[model samples]
Target: MRTLTLVRRVAPLILLLVVLAVLTVRAAEQLDNQDTYFHLRFGHELLGEWSLRDPGSVSSFATADWVPTQWLPQITMAAVEDRAGLAGVAWLSGLAFLALALTLYVVARRRVEPLAAAPLTALALVASSSGLSARPQVLSYLLVAVTATAWLAAARSGRTPWWLVPLTWVWACCHGMWPVGLAIGGVAVLATALRPDRRWDRVARGAAVVALSGLATLVTPVGPRLLGAVVAVDERREFFSEWGRPDPGDPRLLALLALLLVAAAALAWRGTDGPRGPRTLRGLRESPDLTALGLLVLAGGCTVASGRTVPVAAALLVPVAATALHRHLGDRPAWTRLEQVVVLGGVALALPVLAAVVPHTADEPPARPAWTDPALAALPAGTPVLNDWNLGGWLMWRHPQLDPVMHGYGDTFTVEELRRNTDILALRPGWRTLVRETGVSYALVRPRSPLGRALVDDEGWRVLHRSPDLVLLKPPPGWM
Candidate 1:
C-alpha cells in the first residue's frame, strides 16, 4: 500500500521534470534558427495589423501569401510580445510545452499506472523535443495532444465530444499539420465503423465525428486556398528536405525507433495467445479501436524512423503507449512499487548529470548583425534582401523593415521556387541567373560555404560584410 502510494505521488513530478529537461535542452540548442525568425516576423506582422498579408512589401516573392496555418500561434505570440517582448515569447513557448507535458501526463494517468506513465512521458518529451521550435510545428504538437486526449476520452465512454470537431477547424487554420489530426480522427472512425461485433449506432456516431472534423478543416481564414497550398506542398516531397524519406543513419532517432518497435512487438506477442496477459487483448481482437491503436503505433514508428516525422511519432505514441501499458499492467503488483521508487530515484539522481551534459550557454553568434552585409546596411530601409535559409529567421526578426526575398516560410514558397533557389546555389549557372533575376541587392551567405567563397572570388559581386560564419555580398555597381 505504501509502495503504491509513493508511486502515485511521484510519477507526475518525474514526468514534469523530464519534460522540463527536454525543453531546456531544446531551448539551449535551437534558439536562433531561420524558422524562429519566420514565426517572429509573423507575430510582428499580425500584431501590427491583424493580417497575414505583408504590407509595404517589395519582394516579388509572394508577399500576399497567407500563412493561415500558423496564424493562431503567431497571434498568440504577438500577444505574448505585447505583454513581455521577445523574452515573453520564449516564456510563452516554454509554458505551452509545459501544458503539453501536463496533457501527456493526464492521458497517461488515464491509461497506465501513474508510476509507469513517467518513462513513457519522458520518452515522448524527448522524442517531441527534437522538433520543438518557435514555429507552426509547436502548434501542431499541442493540437495533436488535445485531439488524442479527446479521442481517448470519447473512445472510453461511447459518446464522442461535439466540441472536438469545431476545435479541429480552428486547428486547421493554425497549422499545416491539420491533416495529421484528421488522420488520427479517421483512424478512430474507421476503428468504430469496422468493429464486427459492435452495434452499428456507435460506429455511425464515430463516423459522423470524423466527417465533421474533416469538414471543419476547411473553415480557415484562407478557406480552400489553404487546402490547395497544403496539397501542392504535400505533392512536392522531392523539393523539401523535411518532406523527404528519413535517413536510416541517424543514431538517436534510430535507437528510439528500435526501442519502440521492440516494445510494441513484445506487447503484441504477450497479448496474443498468452494466458498470463490481461483480458483487454481478448476483447481488443474484435474492437476496431484497439486495432487502430496498433496501426497508430506502427505509423508512429515509421515516423520516428524518419527524422522528419519525429514530432508526429511523439504526438501519436504517448497515449497509445500509455493505453497499452495500462491494459497490460492493470493493477500494480506490490513488488512493482519498489521498482517504481528505484526508477524515480534514479531519474532524480541523474538530473544533475543530464544537465551537465546538455550545453548551458547559447554560444552561437547573434544571427542578424553577424550575417548582415554593410552594403545591405547602407541600402535604404525596406530594401529586399535575399538571404540563406538558416539566416532568414534572424533577418526577419531584426530587420522587419526589410522584406526578405525568401525566409523560412516553408509553405509560402512553391516547390519550383525552392528548386530554383536550391539549384542556383548548388550550381554556378543557376546561381548567377538567380542573382540577376531576383534583383537581389544583397546576398547573405554562410562564410564556410563554397557559394560564399565563389561570391568573394568573383569580380561581378562585392563582399560587403564578413564574419566567422557569415558573409554578405552585393551585385556589382549598376547591377540592381
Candidate 2:
C-alpha cells in the first residue's frame, strides 16, 4: 500500500523524466549533421579571426557572408571541444536539452494540475522532435520556454519581472529568433490588458517591459545586423525546406497535430456554454488569461502546418495543452490504492518501449549517406572545401582543421546564397558553377548524389578516396 501510494504520487513525474531522458539519449547518439559542422567550423574561425568576419580572405567559401547568430551555444560547444573533443560537444548539447526539458516540465507543472502535467510534458517531449538538432535553435527553444513561463507568471500576478529583459538580449545573441521572447511578452501584456478591473498604469508597465525587452534584443555582438540577417533569411522562405508546407505523409507530425486539434476542441467545448451549462462556461470565460493561452495553441497549429514553425509550435503547445487539460480534467477523482499500483506498474512496464520508438521520427537520418570518407585523412592542409549542408556535421567532427564555405547557419546566409547552393547541389548547372566559383580545391560529395557519380566519371576530377557514403574529389594537376 505504501509503495502504491508513493508511485501514485510520483508516476507522472517519472514518465515525464523518462520521456525527456530518452529524447536526450537519442539526440546524442545521432551523427552530427551539416549544421553542426558549420557551427563547429565557425567556432574555430572565431578562435582565429576573433570576429564573425573572415579576416585572411582565405577562400570565397569562408567569406560567404555568414553570421553566427547562435554564437553563445556554438561557443559553448567549441569550448567543450577544446576540453573533450567532438563527443564532448555532443554530450553538452544533450545535457542542455535535458535541462531544457526539465525547465519546461517545471513551468507546465506550475500552470496545471499535477496529474495533467505528466501527459503535457510527454507531448512537449514528442513535439520537440524537430528542434533536437545541434544547432542554435536548441538554445532558442529553451529561451522561449523561460520567456513564456515568466510572462505567464507576470500575467497572473501583474508583476512583470525586470530580469526578463536582459534574458531577451541574451536570447537574441544566442539565436536570431529573439523576437519570439518579445512575442510571448506581448501576448502576456494583451492578456493583462484585457482584464476590465486592471488599471491602465499596470497594463502600460507590462507593455513597456515587452518593448524594452525587444529593443534589448539589439544589444548582441551583431547589433542591428542581427535583425538584417533574420529578415534576409525569412524573406527567402521559398528556398528553405522547413519554410515549405508540411508533408501529409509524415506520420509523427500528423499524429501530434491531430492530438493538438483534439486538445483544442476539448478546451473550447469545456470552456464554452454547452450541454453541461453556462456555469461551466462562466468559469472559463472569466479567466481571460486562459483564453490568451488558446491563442498560443492556434499559433502552434498554424506553424506546425507550415513545417518551418515546428520549434515555435513545440515551445508554445506544451503549456497550452497543460492548461487545457487542467481546465477540463483537474477535478477528476484520484486512483484508489489498488488502481494506483496497477497504473504505476503499467507505466513502469511501458516506459522502455516508448523510449525506444519515440525519439527519432524517421527510420534513418534524413538525406544522409550510409557511410563517409575519413574527412580528416584525405583533405590537404588548408584545403578550401564546398560541402553539402547535410554532411557538414560529419566534416566538422572529422576535420576540425579545414575551413568550409557554409554549413547549416540558415539565418546567416542570404536567400540568394541559399537558393544558389540548393540549385547547385540538387541540379546540374548550379553544381558546376558552384564548384568553379568557390574555387573549391577538394569536394566532399555524398555517394547518392548525381554530382558525385559525375565527378568519378570525369577525368579532370580525380577520386582520391571513396567510401560507400562519401567520395573525396581533387582537381587534376594544372586545373587549379
Candidate 3:
C-alpha cells in the first residue's frame, strides 16, 4: 500500500517533469519570436539612460505612447544573454514551458484522477503547441492557468484569496494580455453566482476579487493607457497574420472539437439507471471544473478569432478536460510495488540520458540568423539598409551600428512606414523610389521576397551577397 501510494504521488510529478523537459528541449532547439531581439534591446536600454518615465522609442518614428508590458521577460532575457549567452536564453525558455505545464496540471489534478490526468495533459500540450514561443504571451498563458486554478479552488473553499488581487498587478506588468486574468476571474465569479445553490458570500467575495483584479491592472507602466495599446492592436489586427481570424485548418481547432465531442458522448452514454455518476447535466453543472470549461470556451472563442491565442485556449482547456475525463472514467487503480520499482528505475536512468542528449548547447539561437550576421559583416558599419520586417529585431541586435529603416517595434513606426516596408517586399509601384527616398542605398531582403526577384532583373542594382535565405542588394557602381 505504501509503495503504491508513493508511485501514485510521484506519477503526476513525473508527468509534469516530462512535459517540462519536452518544452525546454523545444526551446533549446530554437530561440523565440522576431520580437525577442527588440525586447532584449529595450531591456538593455532600461538598465542605462532609458528611463521608464519617458521610455523613448528605438525605431525611426517617435513613439512616446509606446510601453512594453513584457518588462520582466525583456530584462531577464537580456541578463541571461549577458551572462550565459544563447545557452541561457534556451534554459529560460525551457523553464517557462515547465512553469506553464506545471501550473495547468496543479489546477487540473484537484478535479481529476491521477491516471487520467496524464493523457489529457498531453492532448492539451498538443493543442497549444502553436503558441509555444519565448514571448511574454507565454507568461500570460501561465498566469491564466493559475487564475483558472485559483477560481476553481475558490468555488470549493468559498473564500477568494486576497493575494490574487496583487498577482493581477504583476501579471499586467509581465504581459499585454493581462486582461485574460480578469476575464477568467469574471467567468468563475459569474458561474458561482448563477449556481442553483448559490453561496452569496462566495459570490460577493468573487465579485470583489474580479473587480479588484481589474483595478490592479491599472498599476502598470502604461497605467490606464494600456487600454489604448489593446485598442491599437485590435485596430491594426488586419496587418498581422498571427492576429488574423482563425481558420478551420488550425489543428488546435480539431483537437478542441474532439474534446467537446468526447464530453457529449460521456454524457450521452452515462450509466442510464440508478446511482447516476457525475457525468450527467445536473452533476456537471455542479462540478467545480465547469467554471474551467467556461474559461476554456472563452479562450477557444478568442483562438477562433485569432490564431495567436491558441496558448490561452490550450492552457485553460487541459485542466477542464482532465477533470471531465477523470469524472467520466471514475477512479483508476494504483501500481503495485513491482511496477513502482520498475517505473522509478526507468525514470532514474532516463534522466541522465535526457540531460546528455536533449540540450544542444552549441546550436545557434534561432532568433539570431547566422546567415544575416555574416552578410551584414561585409557591409560597412552604419550603412542605411532596407530589410524584411521580421529581421528588424535581428538587425538591431546584431548590427547595432546600422540604421535599420524598420524592425520588430511596430508601434515605433507609423502606418505609412509599415506600408512602405511592405511595398518594398511586395515589389509594389515606386518601391525603388521609396527605397531611395528613405536614403537606403543598400537593401537586405529575404531571397524569396518579390523585391529580391525584382532586384534580380534590375540593371541598376548589384548583388553584394547572395545566400539561399537572404539577398543583399546595392546600387551599381555609377548608380550609387
Top candidate when judged by lDDT against the true structure: 3
Give the Cα error of residue 455 in candidate 1, in Å: 1.3
Worst 10 residues of 2 by lDDT: 53-62
Ranking by lDDT: 3, 2, 1
Candidate 2 residues 189-227, lDDT tens each? 776767777778878988888888878866666666667
Model 2 regions more than 4 Å off: 1-8, 27-30, 52-59, 62-66, 270-294, 305-308, 329-380, 400-406, 411-415, 428-434, 458-460, 475-480
lDDT of 1 by residue, 182-262 (tens): 777767766666666666887777777778887776766656666766676655566557766665575546535643663
- State the C-alpha lDDT per candidate: 0.63, 0.63, 0.68
Q: Pairs clashing in candidate 3? A: 24-94, 392-407
Per-residue lDDT of model 3, residues 1-480, tens digit only: 999977776675567556655765576565656777787787787766675545766555323366666677888888887886766666666667666665665555556655556555666677778777666677887887777777866766777767789998888778778777888888888888788889898888888998888888776665776656665666555557777776778777777566545534443343444466444533433334547567656865765767777667767766556545555655444544653453344445444443454356523545334566777776777678877888888777767777787776665555677777777777678877877777776878776777767766764478877778888888776553
Q: Is candidate 1 or candidate 2 better by lDDT?
A: 2
lDDT of 2 at 333: 44
Candidate closer to the true structure by lDDT (higher is better), 2 or 3 = 3
The C-alpha local distance difference test score for the whole of candidate 2 amounts to: 0.63
True lDDT of residue 422, candidate 3: 72
Evaluate residue 109 in candidate 1 and report its C-alpha lDDT on the 0 to 100 scale: 62
